[model samples]
Target: MYCFTDPWYLPVDLKLIKSIFQKDFSYFNDHGMYCHPKDNISMNLFNLVNEDWKNLRAKLTPLFSSSKLKSMFQIFVDKAEVLEEVIGSYSSRNEPLNIEDVASRFTIDVITSCGFGIETNALKNSNKEFMKCGVETFNPRLLKFVLMEVVPSGILANLGFKANGAHTNNLFNNLISEVIQYRETNKVFRNDFLQLLLELKQNQEMTDDQIIAQCFGFFAAGFETTSITVMFAMLELALNQEIQNKLRDKIEEVLEKYDGNVCYDAVMEMNYLDKVLNETLRKYPPGPIIPRNCTKTYRVPETDVIIEKGTRVIIPIWGLHRDPEFYPDPEQFNPENFNAENKANRPDMAFIPFGEGPRMCIGLRFGLLETKLALIKLLKNFKYTLNGRTKVPIEIDPEAIFTLKIKEDVWLDVTKI
Candidate 1:
């Protein structure tokens, strides 16, 4: 497929997709997204290419390790508690809850506290500065998005254009600068992502700009993806009452083993919860398309097709996820699709909601944990049903460029169980 003058290839075969993503990764390692050299914020891990990406990925991988995520579990729990209170207020009045909005607030609070080491309290106060920044960052502007994609970063930089707006960049810069200075000066250290970046800085492994960029990346990546996942999962559960009740029962059953606490170990024990989330991801993958740039000329295996250097490749994840060949009754919301027996029947690469290979999202564990914790809190305490305001057969927002989002608000009538 060619979009304008750019040649793009959409590989539908699982083996070829695997080769592109994993076996022959060196041939297509970059996302080919625009990143202006002058835009320091754009130089974060998600945008950095080749060697820079390798170095930054190596430095940041450990920060999301299981042990590190476990240490940060309490932050998720605290924010979820606040979420419960907020949702409780709506449920008490029998009001239709705009769940997407609430979910976004919950994730904003969790990400800011864990990633930036600041308590924005977005869950309680919707007008928090961090909340505003998050909304602005993701609210897609068609012109800016198209410009960033088609125009070369250098040309855009020469034209004095930034990928992100000046306001967003400045807010993150000033906030990060103040936090770093205060922490270093006062010898205040906390067990958070920012603290880990500071340690890297102390060891000369990362620069201050690198630290800020990575933190901004953390917020940008973690905030919306996880929140939308929660929103969609809740919407699906609301639509399917039996599955919702079964999942809630399983959640309660698992918590009893650990004296009714949503601890790291307890969350880990909820296998059914994992299946539900996996199915949710399959139906509504946050990142529906995987884009790659051919870094080296390569030949298709057992074929004469030659992939030229600088060509773009697109993996249609949404198509693959919903393909009836891989998943029977593809549109049905069935957690059984992720059951061990069912999973064994499909290709490993067929269900990549968080992507696959080395370039897979680094915040996979962090995002999953926060989402699961929120579900556990919400499901165990309340029951939800699709409100009349929520249109059936939800429509995807055409303006959403990066992540999967619906045009209508996901409104649900909540009831205290």
Candidate 2:
């Protein structure tokens, strides 16, 4: 077991993360993301490192650029409004709602609109198959897949370990493959993530397996993390009414400046909204720990200790974000931590939600815009408060593989402001 199980797995502060990512990147260039190149369906950008990663990244980068995301903002706005309407209807019934489920559908709608270029109406139909597929794929047991990534197969025998999960494997493979075929045959040109992959399939010599793998990557990367982020953001907003009021004030101010429309440019102008989102991400990073592998033997700069080839390097982002040195009173939800003055005083790597370097998350712009647009519409339409049923200091769902989620139902009451 290469994983550091001896400790409680805490104390991964930002400075240590900077050493692994920026200060000592040459020693830890590759993330030990899951890959089974032989399986074809198992390959994606997340699993690729070095030149292969470089090539795929180049291809996908233009797709998520600022202009591209701006072009797609309408999709986010439409889906977010749908989410607003859906949640509003529920509030009219005076029913305590599980925002976990609502947030899942909201993200799924965004994914379908921006990823597949198809409307999922997940906010409209909670039982959509796409949402179900996402639930299965991100199941906490998927960590077993990650185990195969960092540890050698021989070591597995000693641990009684197997990497694959049947449910997630089957669900992702089928869902992605079907989406690709449907797009290709229909000659759809909506210019979303899947459509881009389809164009590659037609224009490039990339195999069906590669196409499907990229689609799978889109699904995995796009859906769960953003959904969980919205969930946490809403949860925080519900608990902190003063913060919510401040955020709502900012949203209304921005919209009023743009002629009562929450346009792409208006979302861009939301400085405080951006701060709240950044603070939420800081307190509850989607993937709190980042894992990398030492591709070659290297010695620590200050110490004589030599890290062998294939050494597993873990950067605890969550621990670092909460470190008192970088972010004083890290436990408190303070948007001021991200204000221009305080932000300029902080270290470069203290805030790494989307990561840094050439391998940074490609979908970051799109992800943030989608999240912001949702919050804008949601807060503008309704005021949220933590319902009595919701547990304080909510427990993180143990079953989520790549993101933090509420294990139990998180209910919030909404009243139109």
Candidate 3:
């Protein structure tokens, strides 16, 4: 079948998937997740389409460049330390550590530190107000999720509907606005993403709501993507002890060069960590499906199949990531699958944990750096094993069909080494 009877269309051929992402770029600029002007909180990069997306994304892109990442590396290093101290307590209690919970805490602080100039210390203080808002932001409402993802956003906006509640939206708006204002008034400058966004505001083209949307957008995309990636990576490590030990050994050797500091330089040098993260993303990609709206009529290259404009395309990233033909023994959690020689042996598009194309996640670089740094700190200081509370042979939450969300806590017994 060239198309499905449902509202979505599937590009059955892998080449068509690439075509949608990169080859026929003009035809599919939007990811199809919608936003409305009525809900300023709903107006984020992930939901934007066409010109609005292009304009806003252009302003934010340069800030995430390589040089900029280097300037912000220390903030991530500090959070890694907090992760160690926080998780250490769980080890001392001899309690089964819920990695899903702990990992969320780590990413929350990362978002606060990176998005705002101040550290909310979410990992250290669980009851911080920002923590509550952060949770409310990510744990999206069921109806809102359907409306934002399934229904046309213009219709919802026309009917006076929004993706987030006013109370929750106000909290984020007030928090980010206050932080930026305080920074400007006090001449408090920080080498972080927030500073970059603040600088963009000087252009006179960026508005407070746009800035707020971007800050919240970082959390929306970064929070679950980074945290869940870590959770799945840890879960895999717990089940595959041999692979875990090998990675730990590599971490120890590298940290010694940095005097045991989990610095950007040190983490980047750890080739094994990259392999491990690559493998985890392969088995359980953060965004399982790449959703895109066909903005113009297009025909598949070398085929007569025509996809009409305004059609929604679902790129089955999860299916492609696990295709046995591309990845031999696709079910196993093996880091060697990402080994230099092995990776080169496979097609480049086959391993797109981050969606392929101009609209692909730019924050993926920061996500990878943060995740690898977290693993570096954890593995170097402690050891983990599967706890009784965890379900064996893991499964994703049905509700989290778009993103990989485990139904149960990926509880692990942590032992300080």
Candidate 4:
């Protein structure tokens, strides 16, 4: 494909995507999205160069391990409990709840807890400064989007244009610095992502900016994706009562085996929830495109085509996910499609919600865990129905350059079950 006469490669076939993303990974080491090192908030795994991404990924890999996730389980549960209370109030009011806004608050609290190592009350105090700052950070204006995605990072930096908000960076940096100083001054140790980064700093002598940049990345990247997942999942359940009731029954039954408590183990073991999540991701992947910059000349396998270095590659996830060949009745919100039998029948790369191969989302585990927990808790107590206020055939916001979300609010009527 040609974009403004520039040779742009849009790989439609799953095999082609796998080839570019995996087989020829060496030729496409960078994401094509660059973050100037001087811009601390932008120097995350998503924007880091080849070697930098690899090393930092290895260091941060341990933070998302099962053990590490379990250690942070209470933080999620605590936040979910708050979420439950907030929802209960809405249910009592017999009013429509804005799932997008509410879900954003829920995820913001979770990400802040994990990233900042502090209990954040975004659920209670929706107008919190950090919450607002986080929203602005991800909700890039048109100019910012053009500057970051269209223009080269080097050019943008030279022009003194920052795609990332300096206000957002300062807020996050100040927050991290304050917390780190408190932890150091009090000689208090805790098991969290920040603590892990702190240890890495001590051993590797990483700059404070480096650590803060990652923490800021963790906060910025984690929140919206999970929020969108929950919003869509709930919307699907609202529209499909049978699925909702069945899922609720499964949740109740599973919680019974675990003493009626929604623990990490029980949540993880809910097979139906897993299927629903898989189906949701298939239909509404947070990131609908995977991007990479070809760093070396690479000959296409079994073909005479040669992609020159510096050529950009785009893996169109939306097209693939919606393709009827891979998913019959692609628009249907059926969790059955993700059942073991059906899943086994499909090609591995047919679903690339979190991308594929080595460059896949490192935060996938934590993100899934958070989504599952939220669904378990939300459905355990309340039921939702698509309200009149909700626009059917939800439209995607063209403004959301990087994520998939409704342009406006997702409204649903809530009732305590």
Highest TM-score among the candidates is held by which one? 1
Query: TM-score per candidate, in order?
Result: 0.98, 0.89, 0.94, 0.96
Q: What TM-score quantifies how close candidate 3 is to the native fold?
A: 0.94
Quick one: RMSD of model 2? 3.4
**What are the per-residue Cα lDDT tens digits for candidate 2 across 247-310?**
9998888889899988888888999999999999999999887777788787765667677776
Higher lDDT: candidate 2 or 4? Answer: 4
The lowest-lDDT stretch of 10 consecutive residues in candidate 2 is 2-11
Question: Can you rank all candidates by lDDT, best first?
Answer: 1, 4, 3, 2
Candidate 2: lDDT over CA atoms?
0.76
TM-score of 4: 0.96
- Compared with the true structure, what per-residue lDDT tens digits does model 1 show for residues 151-186? 778889888786767777888999999999999999
lDDT of the structure predicted as candidate 3: 0.82
Q: Largest lDDT belongs to which candidate? A: 1
Global lDDT scores for all candidate models:
0.89, 0.76, 0.82, 0.84
In candidate 3, stretches whose alpha carbon ends up further than 4 angstroms from where it belongs are 1-6, 127-142, 149-152
Model 2 segments more than 4 A misplaced: 1-16, 23-26, 142-179, 182-186, 397-401
Clashes of each: 0, 3, 0, 0
- The number of clashing residue pairs in model 1 is 0
